[model samples]
Target: MIEPTAEPAVEARGLTKRFGSKLAVGGLDLRIEKGTVFGFIGPNGAGKSTTIRMLMGLLPMNGGDATVMGIDVRQRPEAVRRCVGYVPEQHLIYRWMRVKEVLWFCRQLHEAWNESLARELCQQFELSGQTKVRHLSKGMLAKLALIIALAPEPELLILDEPMAGLDPIIREEFLETVLQSFCRGGRTIFFSTHMLGDIQRLADSVGIIHDGRLLVHGSVADLLSRTKRVRLALERDELPAELPQGVIRTWRNRRECVLTITDCDSQKVQHLEDAAQVRVVEVLDVGLEDIFKDYIKGQREAI
Candidate 1:
């Protein structure tokens, strides 16, 4: 077993997973530093869940290697689990148990469980001890899961689409909770979600995956700064089959060509417009989601 490192909270090298003939995650690699909030963003069936499961050791990988909290995931799965807190997309507690009963069960299993922190998170998450798991609303169930994940005070938090089915209000609350915890100190967060808005809200760094492959991965600031959505007004009734370098996606509609590009700025936009013989009508700043969408669109059209 590898000793826990003070630097990398999570690391993967050529991590691979498969189910039957389908490659769910393929040759995936990522490095999440300690105390960083790393968001994994992708559409459904993009291998995000499969990758998270691999990290949690809930599903075995077919190839490659991974580590969490510096413990080799495949070699010492139990040690890796000890230092990671996991929140899955769906509720998993027994329906018959009361909220507090589940907590008691978890506390018994984890010798390192901090009771004070557990109590604190229970209050913050507004979970009631007396309420049966069966009677909890979807939002309440989500909150309960968060409290359980937090109570352990694990060094790394692994969340798998925890906010997937939540309403905007609840999602906002969840984001707030995550942000508060992140600001507290020295904890690493690795989460996968289709909710790009949540990624923008909670992540310092992000990785984008699609069809068992990584599309982009880097600091959120760097990604947003490099990507842009540009709108061009075509003076001539012609559409070029190819656009200038860095244009990830371009499509003509009526008299305009809308495009998204990476490694672009104002000067580059001007140059592109001149080269393409189009007027630069608008150049818009984009978030992580827009960049991901543009890439996916480009990939689809290419195929």
Candidate 2:
């Protein structure tokens, strides 16, 4: 038996995948610590699903290696699968099956199925155990998928856009449930989503990817401190012709300009205001969405 403390919940080294002429995932290396929520932020068609599929052994890797729970995902995929709970971006259950049937099938396949856990999730999510998969609403279906993923009680959970089209209340409930599950320790979650608000509220660390490349990965506080959003109240109508080195994005309005600095110190921010001959009316903290935008813009400029 592999020792429990030997490896991270998920680790990928030089992971690459390609589709025809386009490279979907490019030589990516990832490490997800146990008991942490790692958010994957990227635009549509940025190879987020492709990477997750390869890790789950649903798709073959063109290059590199990945492991889940100390088992090689490519060589011993079944063992890796047994340790992972996955909620895909799209529904993957059989429409003809009833809720109970689906859960029973999962119970047969996974050694870690917890019947009590499934029942509790179903009750909390307000799902009908007897309802057929085809008859459930979109939110109910999403809830079912979550329950299935949690029922197994796997060591790691990989969710792709788990909050796609649900009501705000349901989304909050789902996030709370995930947090509750993680409280026990030694369980990790890797979630990919466009919902920046939920990411901000829940993520322990974030990884930003753009055009098949990772731009930045760090704690939320580290990212916020490294990036700045400054609103300058200027006497003049236009920004300075020469700007600082770390300014990533800038937008100008009448007698005012909002500047985004990617790598900024307090002195640099002060210098920018002074150089523009403006008074800093407000220097608000940057949110996850702003950081994501700056990261994408930086990536585009690099290409």
Q: How close to the true structure is residue 187 of candidate 2, measured as C-alpha lDDT?
A: 83
**How accurate locally is residue 246 in candidate 1, as Cα lDDT from 0 to 100?**
80
Tens digits of lDDT, candidate 2, 6-93? 5677889889988998999998888777777899989998888898899998899999999887789999887777788889999889
Q: How far is candidate 2 from the true structure (C-alpha RMSD, Å)?
A: 3.9
lDDT of each: 0.83, 0.83
Q: In candidate 1, what are the lDDT values of residues 195-217, reduced to their tens digit? A: 77777777888998888998888
Using TM-score as the measure, which candidate wins? 1
Clashes, model 1? 0
lDDT of 1: 0.83
**TM-score, model 2 to reference:** 0.86
